[model samples]
Target: MKVRKPRLKAVDFFCGGGGMSYGMLEAGINVLAGIDYEPNCKQTYEHNITGAQFIKADVFELQEQELEDKLNLTKNDDNLILIGCSPCQFWSIINTDKTKSTKSANLLIEFTRFVKHFNPGYVVVENVPGVLRQKKESGLEDFIIWLKENDYKVHFEVHNVAEYGVPQSRKRFTLIANRVTDESIDLIKSVERKVTVRDVLGQVNGFPEIKDGHKDKTDFLHTVASISEVNKKRLKKVAKDGGDRLGFANDTELQLACFEGKDNSFKDTFGRLWWDKPSPTITTKFFSISNGRFVHPDEDRALSLREGATLQSFPKEYKFYGTSTSAIARLIGNAVPPQYAKCIGEAIINNHLNAV
Candidate 1:
C-alpha cells in the first residue's frame, strides 16, 4: 500500500486579499484560517481562497487561546505555521522624511505574543527592506536577542521580487523562522531569472486592450490618473513605446522635484513602459503619471486592474473587491505577489517532507 504525505497547515495574519494563502495553497499546503481587521477583505479572501476560514478581528485584541479555539487548533500539532506581514508604512524609508509613527511597529510585539503562546513550528514574515532598520523602546539589539531567546532558527534576507519571477522591480524583506535546526533551515536558495512585463502580460485568451479606470465585466479596474491639460500635451510629446519626458523637455517644467538640476538622471516618471523589461514597483497610486513608470506602453491611460494584477504575479482569474479605483488598487497594492509566496511555501513543504 502507498502512504499519503501528511499535509502542513498554516494560518495567515493580516491576510489582505489572500495572496500569500494562494501561493501556499498552490504549493499543496492547507491554509486553514486567515485573520485580518478589514471586513471587506473577508469577501475577497473567501472568493479567491476556497475552503479557508476567515476571521475579521484586530489581532492584538484577541488572546492566543481565543485564536487557537477559533481556528480549532490543538497543542499537539507541530505542523502549524504562523505567518504575519504587519503593515510597513510606519517603518518604510519613504516615510522617513516625515514623522515616523510607532503605532504599526507595535504590531510586531503583538505577533510575538502569539508566537510565545502557540509556539508554532514555523513562522514567516514579509515586509519592506526598511523593516530591518526599525527600533523601539527595547531597541534593535534587544529585538534580535529576543527572537534568538525563543530558540528560532531565523533566516532573513532582502530580495528583489523580479529575481523570484515577479515582473516588478520590487524589493522586500523576507524571514523564515523554524524551530527545527538542520541543513533544511536555509532560506536563501538559487535565484530564478528576472520576470519581465512581457512575460506576464503575454497572451491572455479573452480580455485585451485594458483602459484606465475601466472595470471589466468582473467589476475590477486599476486607478486612473487625473492629468492636467498642460501635462497631457507634454505626455503626448514624449512618444510611445517606452518613451519618457526627457524626449520632449526643452526648458520649462524640465526640473522634477527629485531631479531638480541633475543630468544623466533617468527614471520613468510620467513615462511609458517598455513592453520587454520588468515594470517599476506598483505603488498605492500606480495609476498616476508621477507615481512611477505607470503609463501604458500603447494606450493614453495607465494600466488597468487586470494589468496591475498580472504584473503583481496574480493569476488572471483572481477576483478583487470594490468598483472604485482607489479601493481596488488598495486591495491589489497591499497583497503579496502570489508567485513569490508560492516559492517560499514550496521550499518549506519540500524541507518538511524530506525531513519526515
Candidate 2:
C-alpha cells in the first residue's frame, strides 16, 4: 500500500489579494484563511483561492484567543503553519516616505501574538531586506529572540526572487522556524532557471502589440495608459530595443524641465525595458510611463494590468476584481509574487512537515 503524506495547513497574515495564500496552496498546503485590513481584498482573495476564507480586520485589533477560536489552531501542532508576510514597503525603500512606514512597522509584532498563542509547526516570514536592516523598529529582532527562547530553530536569509524563476528583480528576507525537530531548516532553491523579459513578453508570449490607450476587445486587462502628444513624440525618438530617457534629451522641446541641467538623474525613470533582461521591479506605479522603466521594449506605452501581473508571476487565469484600474494595479503591485511564495512554502514543508 502506498502511504499518503499528511496534509500541511497554513494561515497567511497580511494576505492582500491572496498572492501568498495562493502560492501556499499551489505548494500542496491547505491555506485555512487570509487576514488583512483592506476590505477590497476580500473579494479577490476569496474568489481566487479555494478552501480559504478572507478575514477583513486589522491584525492589531485581533486577539490570540479569537484566532484560536476561529481557526482551531493547536499549540505546537506540527501539521500547522503560520505565515507572516506583512506590507512594510514604505520603510523598505530608503527614498520613500518613512512616516507612513512607522505606523505599520509593528505589524510583525501582531503576527507574533498568534505565534505566541499557538507555537505551530513552523513560522514563515517574508519581507523586504530593510526589515532586517531595521530589525530594531520592525520587531524582527525581538521576534527572532522569542522564537529562540521558545526552542525554535530558525533559518533566515535575503533572496532575490528573480533567482527563483520570477521574471522580475525582487529581493525579500525570509525566515523559517521549526520547534518539532532539532535540525535547522534549509531553503532549497526552485528547480526553474532564471527567466528574462524575452522569455515572457512580446507577441509570441500571448502579449501582442498594443498601442497607448489601446484596449484589446477580448481582454480589457491588456490596455495601456494614454500619453500626451509630446510624450508620444518622445516615445518615437527612443531606440527600439532598450532605450533610456536620453533618447530625447537633444529635443529641446521634449526635454523635461526638471532634468534640464542634470545629465544622469533618475536614469531608470521614463526608460524602456530591455527585452533581453528581466524587467525592473513592478511597483504600484507600473501603469505610468513616468514611473520606473515601465515602457514596453518596442511598443510606445507603459505595461498593461495583465502585463504587470504576468511579470510579477501571477498566473493568466488569476482575476483581480476592484473598483478601478488603479485599485486593481495596487492589488497586483502590492502582492507577493506567488512563485516566490511557493518556494518559501515548499522549503518549510521539506523542513518539518510532520505527518499526523
Candidate 3:
C-alpha cells in the first residue's frame, strides 16, 4: 500500500491580496489563512483563493493564541509553515519622504514576535532590499540573530525576480528558515528561460486601445490614466520600441524644465518598454507614463491596470477590489509576485521532503 505524504499547512501574514497565498497553493501547500490590516483586500483574497480564510486585522494586535485557535493550529503540527512579507514602504529606497525613523520601520520585528511564539517548522520572509540596509533601525540583523539562537537554520539573499520567470526586473530580499533539517536549501535557481514582455503579453487578445482616462466598457480594469494633451503629443512622437522622453531633449519647448540644461538623470521616466525585454519594476503609479518606463511599447498610452497586474505575474482571472484605479495599483504593486512566491514555496517543500 502507498503511504500518503504529510500535508504542509501555511499561514500568511501581511498577506496583501493573497499573492503569496495563491503561490503557495500552486506549490501544493495547503494555505490555511491570510492576515492583513487592509480591509480592501478581504474580497480579493477570499474570492480567488479557495479554502483560505482572510482575517482583516493588524498583525501587531494579533495574539499567537488567537491565530492558533482561528486556524486550529496546534503546537505539535510538524509541517506548519509561517510566511510573512511585511509592509516595506519605510524600508524602500524610493520612499524619499520617509526615513527609517517612521512608525513602519519596525514591522519586521512585529513579524518576528509571531515567529518566536509559534516556532513553526518553517518560516519565510520577503521584503525590499532596503530592509537590509536599515539594519540599525529595522532590526533585520537582530531578527536573523534571534532565528539562529532559537535553533532555526536560516538562509537569506537578494534576488532578481526576472530569473524566476516573472516578466519584470524586480529585486527583493528573501529569507527562509527551517528547524527540521540541516541539509542546505537554495531559493535561487535558473529557470528554463527568462520571460519577456512579448512572451507573456504578445498573444493576449481583447485589449482595446484606450485613450487617457477612459475605462474599457467590457473590462473595467483595462482602463488607462488620463494624460494631458501635451503629454499625448509627446507620446505620439516617441518610437514604438524602447523610446523615451529623451528623444525630445533638443526641443526646448517640449522638454521638461529639469532636462533643459544637460540634465539627463531621469531618462527612465516617460519611457516605453522593449517587447523582447523584461519590463521595469511595476510601481504603484504604473498607469502614468511620467512615473517610469511604463509607456506601452506599441500603444500611445501607459500600462492599464490589467497590464500592470500581468507584469507583476498575477493570473489573468484574478480580480482586484478597489474604488479607484490608484487603490488597486497599491495592492498590485505591493504584492510579492505570485510566480516568485511559488518558486520560494517549491524550495520550502523540496527541503521538507528531502529532510523527511
**Per-residue lDDT of candidate 1, residues 140-195 (tens digit):** 33544666787766777788878777888888888787765453354443355677
Q: What does candidate 2's lDDT look like per residue over 147-197, in tens digits? A: 999899988999888888889988889898988778777666664667888
TM-score of each: 0.87, 0.95, 0.94
Model 2 TM-score, all chains together: 0.95
Residue pairs whose backbone atoms clash in candidate 3: none
Off by over 4 Å in 1: 1-5, 96-101, 135-144, 184-192, 202-207, 210-215, 219-228, 251-267
Residues forming the 10-long window of minimal summed lDDT in candidate 1: 135-144
The segments of candidate 2 whose C-alpha lies over 4 angstroms from its true place after superposition are 1-5, 216-220, 353-356
Q: For model 1, which pairs clash?
A: 222-305
lDDT of 3 by residue, 9-94 (tens): 89999999888999999888999999998899999999878999999887779888898888888874559988989888788888
RMSD in Å for all candidates: 3.1, 1.9, 1.9
Model 2 lDDT-worst window of ten: 347-356
Residue-level error in angstroms, candidate 3, position 234: 1.2
Tell me model 3's lDDT, rounded to 2 decimals: 0.85
